[model samples]
Target: MIADRARQAAAAAALVGCLLAAHGTAAADAAAGARLSAARCASCHSSTETIHSTVPLLEGQPKAYFIAQWRAFRERKRTAPVMVNLAGELSEKDVADLAEHYAALAPPPAALASGSDTGRALADRLRCAACHGSALRGTHAGAARLAGQKVQYTTWSLQLMRSGTRSHGTAAKPDPLLADLSNAEIESLAAHLASLR
Candidate 1:
């Protein structure tokens, strides 16, 4: 319990620091971002399909949040190997442009799968809506939309967050409650959320 609290506190601090950084970043052009994405990001993040179950669907993510995540990846604060290299390849303008491109897209459909019934209740208890919006479509404040995220990606992401390997940018703390979740429980939760519009 203490460890979970500590992790949450650390995450909260990081969120503040990141939100501050986001305010001063420059704007980007979606067209320019699209061109760059085609070259560097398309293979893994292609909205047409899930290349891997763990890769996130980037469409309609909040632009500022998207920029902040790329910046974090570029700066070595985040821990995705492919994203770090891709983010490093981008110039500041490219980062902004790419964020713009992804942000302008409509949320694509994800492959939904079967799971237990507890996920929705767990999400309610977690108050996911406090940050992800009532409908989970994301906000300018940094939450990514979860409604159409791949079930595998969502389950993996929740596990990472619970295990302290990933975070919801810098705004909120990792949920200590998730530490008690079994793998099947996490999958059920992910499945339910993915079923939302």
Candidate 2:
């Protein structure tokens, strides 16, 4: 009984320490984040408003996800040239600050594209629902939420998969059905998926 109580006490202390660290991190300077956003990310990406169709609206993304992506970019695991260059200069604290800033911003409206019958049929046949869920909200096992994502990013990711430039893993290979889709078809699907949110 005494050992169990001691372990519980230790766990409570650790949880308190974690909470304090999180609070301290959240209190980091917003001005520094604004400066970093302008200097490092504003050129190709928009931090304040949604103007570009190709670039994703980083605003309102989960801070944890944003931080993870930034770390991936910095490590070259993400393989995006723009992100690689931007993330390379950011320290861990800068990444946390930037994630906080972006997470606090509002998400932009989603643009829905009318899907061609062929594209819709293709999507249905390919069982996109299996991984993306009925609402495309993503699953916990690496499937990303397709809903509310930028259409350009969605299409580009599909194109990458089709061209074998990007593959999730051996267990999650690119669906062969997508390989033959025309650019217009891809765009239509992307727009349809984006409309979910």
Candidate 3:
């Protein structure tokens, strides 16, 4: 219980920091962002049918969260070959526009939960809601929306975080909550998260 509370406190602190950092942003132009996305991001991110299993769905993400991630990729604080290169090309206004565009779109629908009850229990114990909102739909705290996310993407991301290959750029720390979980447990947690709408 104490450990869980500690984690929640940490998450809350991170949220506050992000909120402060994202303050004073200019209004974004979603229309311009749409055009830019169509021109540049369509090949991978726009196509629901052709997108890889590991590609996260960005629609309906919080604008602050989206902007933070885009900047991370652009600054090379978070590393993905294509995203680093692509995000590098975007201006600050371009990122804000894209954030607005994607944030306004509807998120993906929920999928069936294939995991057992244990997954739900694990999420409850972990208090994922502390960071992800009551519905796991995300928060203005710079946390990504998790509801109805692709299972494969969630699973892979957890594994990367656990293995220390992925981390929050600002925090620079892998989630300790994920460190001790087994592969099967991570998959179960991902399934539970994917099932929420």
Using lDDT, give the best candidate's number.
3
Instruction: Between candidates 1 and 2, name the one with more favorable TM-score.
Output: 1
Weakest 10 consecutive residues of candidate 1 by summed lDDT: 108-117
Task: Give candidate 2 regions above 4 Å deviation.
Answer: 1-35, 47-52, 104-106, 110-143, 169-177, 180-182
Q: Considering lDDT, where higher is better, how would the candidates rank from best to worst?
A: 3, 1, 2
Assess every candidate by TM-score: 0.77, 0.62, 0.78
On TM-score, the candidate that comes out on top is: 3
| Order by TM-score, highest first | 3, 1, 2
Any runs in candidate 1 off by more than 4 Å, and if so which? Answer: 1-27, 47-51, 113-117, 168-174
lDDT of 3 by residue, 1-197 (tens): 99999999999999998898788566789999899888887556644453567888887788888888888898888888999998888889898898889888865664455656978988898788888789887788788888777778888998888777888433445768777889999899999888777
Q: For residues 1-197, what per-residue lDDT tens digits would candidate 1 score against the true structure?
A: 99999999999999999988888666678888888888877777765455566787787778777878888898898878988997888788887788789888866655555444598887888788888889987888777887777788898888888887776555344657677888988888899877776
lDDT of each: 0.79, 0.69, 0.80
Q: How many backbone clashes does candidate 3 have?
A: 0
Model 1 accuracy (lDDT, Cα):
0.79
Backbone clashes, candidate 2: 0
